[model samples]
Target: MLRVENLVRRFGGITATDNLSLDVARGELHAIIGPNGAGKTTLISQLTGQLLPNSGAIRFAGREITTMPSYKRSALGLARSFQITSLLTDFTALDNVALAVQAHDGHSFYFWGSARNEKHLREAARSALARVGLGHRADVVVSELSHGEQRELELAVALATKPQLLLLDEPMAGLGITESARMVKLLQELRQEVTIVLVEHDMDAVFALADRITVLVYGRVIASGAPSAIRQNEEVRRAYLGDQHAVTDHA
Candidate 1:
């Protein structure tokens, strides 16, 4: 569903994404894992069009979107959920998602006075919230929700667009064990519905959820294959996993 070819991006003398290339198949969950400074976020930024590659190409479902603006990408069924929570803390969870629906489908947040009050937008928002297990918390102010709920709300916001491929940047970044487990289960279910490209540090989550894992080092792919193969890869263990052998223990 997504293909990146010879992708390169640099900052002054530093190369962030060096001839990076990878592909995500339809209906499969592909995970990108690497240590800090490995360029995972840079790759995602370029894929989402937030940061254009210095050179190379990105194609989604057969359409070239390398330089397409992020909003245009969204229109083409690409959506991203960031590592950090991107929610309107003052609004109810339902309101936040409803605005996404309005922006994606209605093309304007103000097409109707308040998105949550528009029956169509409201119903869609409700469905997204329910999918992310946030239905009962819909009316709660984002600021008042727990950190875990906020993270779930972010997923709901992304789902509101009905994306074909969901790019999640560390959805479990701040969660505790219990919350993380809940997220893992939620993703297991979500993967059945949408193609997912995940960038996360949580090895247990990555190994548990990934259909394929790509290891990156200094902006290049060090290894890419099934979880078992990645675990036995000497270089992957040497560079990133580094006794981070939770890799072998996850499944």
Candidate 2:
């Protein structure tokens, strides 16, 4: 459903993404793993139109979206959750998601009515919250939410867009063990409904959830295969997974 071909992004003397190429089939959970500075976030930025590539192409479904603006990309059924929480601190969780639903519906100008009073937008937002297991917290202020709840809220906000492809950037980051497990479960559930491109540092979660894994080192893809193959790849072992293994063993 998504295709990236020979994508490159450079900043002066440094290359962030170097000729990276990959495809994500419909309903597949594709994970990208790499050491720090491997250009994972850069690749995402290019794909989501937050950063235009210096060269190469990105196609979603069938059409090329390399130069499409970020809002246009979002309108075309692509959604992303950032590594950092991007919720509005003062807004209620439901209000934040309702605004997202309203934005997609092209009705952002409606200012007077409580966004919560718009039944369709409210229902849509509530459903998104329920999907992320946050229905009960819908009325709570984002600032009052725990870190894990905030992460879930991020996913809920993304889902409010009804995206066909979900780009997740380290959904498990900054969570406690139980919270991480909860996120893994939520992501596993989401896989049944949408295609995912996961950029994660949690190897166990990646191995458990990814239908396929791509390994990146120094802004280049060094390996791409199934979980088992990725686990055994020498280059991956030498670059990232070896460190992952050591951490796992010590833990």
Candidate 3:
């Protein structure tokens, strides 16, 4: 569903994304794994239009979107959840999701005084919340939710847009063991609904959920294949996996 070809993005002398390229097939959970400074996040930023590439091409669902604005990319069925939580702290979880729904529907934020009063918006928001297991906490303010709950809420916010491709940047960033397990389960279920591109530091979760793994080093793909193959890749191990990551049943 997504294709990146020889993409390059440089911050002066530092090339964050150096001729990076990859493809994500429809309905697959493609995981991007690498050590720190490997440019995974930079690549995602380019995909979402938060940063423009110095050169190369990006295509989504067959169309060129390398230069499309972030909002335009979102409108074309692409949604992203940040590495850090992005939410309206003072608002209710339902309100935050409803706002996402409102925005995706092309309803100007100023059109209605609030998204809460709109029945359609509320219903959509509720559905998104339920998908991410946040329905019961819909009325709770974002600031009051637990860290895991906040992460779940962020997923709900993205899902509220009805995206076809979900770009997740380290969804398990700060979660504990149990919370990380829950997120792995959630992503397992979600992958059935939408194509996902996951950038995660949690090797366990990555091995558990990724249909295919792509390993990056110095902003370039060193290895890209099935989980089983990736685990045995010497180059991948030398570059990033090191001696820490253990073999999972996936191999």
Candidate 4:
């Protein structure tokens, strides 16, 4: 569903992505794992068109979107959730998702006043919230939601776009043990329906959820294969995993 070819991004003399390339199959959950400064986020930024690659190409569903604007890429069914929660704290969870639905419909924020009252938009928003297990909190203000709920709200906002491929950046970043487990379950269920490219530091989550794993070090892929193969890869172990044998660290 997604292909990145020779993707490179640099900052002055520092190369964030060094000739990185990978492919994500349809309906598969592919995880990108690496240590800090490995350029996982940069790769994601380029893929979503937030940051254009210095050179190389990115294609989604077979069409080149290397130069497509971020909004345009989103319109073409690429949706992402940030590592940091980006939510309208003043808005109700339902309102936040409804606005996403409004944007997906090609309407600008100016039309939100009327769009908020639109039954279809509200219904779509409700559906998205329900999909992320946030239906009960639909009317609650985002600020009042727990950290995990806020993270789930971000996913709801992304899902409102009805994306064919979901670019999830550390959905398990700031959760408690229980919360992380809940999110893992949610993603396990979600992977059944949509293609996902997960960039995460949580190794347990990555190994548990990823159908395929790509290990990146200094912005280049060291290994790419099933979780078991990634675990046994000497290069991956030397570059990232190190002496960390246990992958399941919920705490």
Candidate 5:
């Protein structure tokens, strides 16, 4: 569970997040949707301790983590998958996840043995890959992976930490229809195991995966509710979903 209260962040004269307040319940999937420049990423940065808020508070699992360092936050069960793929091009997918597992297991400083040779680390890494449906591609180099596989790898790395809350930023950004559907299925399966705070432009995925949705515009929360409630909200229609509806009708 996480709680963000009256969070505000600014860049020079611009306000990126304006007193944003929200909560993610234990084991719930919460999605934040907004147009470009809506400050969704900024809010995530603050929550993950990548950026300090101008004011307000962030609490995770009952402790105030607003001022904790990023690595410390990760150690405390907060893991994130970035919007862009962050992987080692030369490393095998298994090696990449193994490093994550090593980091989580407090053995990352060991350099004598190949991470692959450490059975405990390898098993942990393989389990994470299995969770993301990437077990078969463990030995493949990241450069050889398709875009969708890379995305799944990102999720696997995050899962290697055994996070209580997973913060995902646009996991479907560049996927084809089938790939997106695959991602949806994987996320749905993951929902039963971890709390998720998803930030995505894919409305279908958001609707299908999110237990609740929060709409952000101009760096402020415009709406927050269940899928059905968000669909029927007049403010949400005028501020965000109107264009989506028009596109859907034409399609």
Candidate 6:
């Protein structure tokens, strides 16, 4: 469903995405794993149009979107959640999700007042929140929710767009063990419904949820295959997995 070819992005003298090429099939959950400064986020930024690539191409569902703006990409069925929580601190969870729905429908900013009262928007937001296990906390202010809950809310907002591909950057970054497990479970269920490109530090989650794993090092692909193949790859182990081997041993 998604294809990238020879994508390169640079910052001054540093190469952040060095000729990275990858493919994500329809309905597949592809995980991107790498150590810090490995350029995973840079690749994602280029794919999502947050940062235009210095060169190369990105195509989704058969059309090139390399130069599409972020909002246009979102409109074209691509959505992403940041590594850090991005939410309106003062807004209730439902309100935040409702805004996402409004944006997806291309409603003007001036329509928000009436949009909030629209039953369809509220219902859609509520359904998205419920999908992310936040239905009961809809009225809670984002600032009042726990970090894990906030993270889930982020997913809800992304889902409110009804994206065909979901790009999640470290959804488990700051969660507790139980919360991480919950996110994993939610993702496991979600993979059945949509294509996902997960960039995460949690090996357990990557091994548990990814249909295929792609390891990146210094903006280039080091390995790409099924989870088992990635776990067994010597280059992957040495370059990223290190000596833990938990990707194979535990999962």
* Model 2 misplacement above 4 A: 110-114, 243-251
Give per-residue CA lDDT, model 2, range 129-233, as digits (tens).
Answer: 999999999999999999999999999999999899999999999999999999999999999999999999998899889999998887899999888778777
Give the poorly placed runs of model 5, Cα more than 4 Å off: 110-113, 243-251
Candidate 6 lDDT, 116-209, residue by residue in tens: 7989989999999999999999999999999999999999999999999999999999999999999999999999998999999998898889
Model 1 is weakest, by summed lDDT over 10 consecutive residues, at 106-115
Tell me the tens digit of each residue's lDDT in model 4 across 1-251: 99999998999999999999999999999999999999999999998988988999999999999999999999999999998999999989999999999999987676557667999999999999999999999999999999999999999999999999999999999899999999999999999989999999988788889889999989989999988888878888888887674243333
Candidate 5: tens digits of C-alpha lDDT, residues 20-138: 99989999999999998999989999989999999999999999999999989999999999989999989999999999988887775558356878899999999999989999999
Model 3, position 233, has a per-residue lDDT of 84
Candidate 3, residue 86: CA error in Å? Answer: 1.0
Give the TM-score of each candidate.
Answer: 0.96, 0.95, 0.97, 0.96, 0.95, 0.97
lDDT winner between 4 and 6, please give it: 6
Candidate 6 achieves a global lDDT of: 0.92
Q: Which 10 residues in a row give candidate 6 its minimum summed lDDT? A: 242-251
Off by over 4 Å in 6: 246-251
TM-score preference between candidates 1 and 2, better one = 1
* Model 2: per-residue Cα lDDT at residue 230: 80
What's the C-alpha lDDT at position 157 in model 2? 91
Where model 4 places Cα greater than 4 Å from the true spot, the runs are 246-251
Q: By summed lDDT, which 10 consecutive residues of candidate 5 come out lowest?
A: 242-251
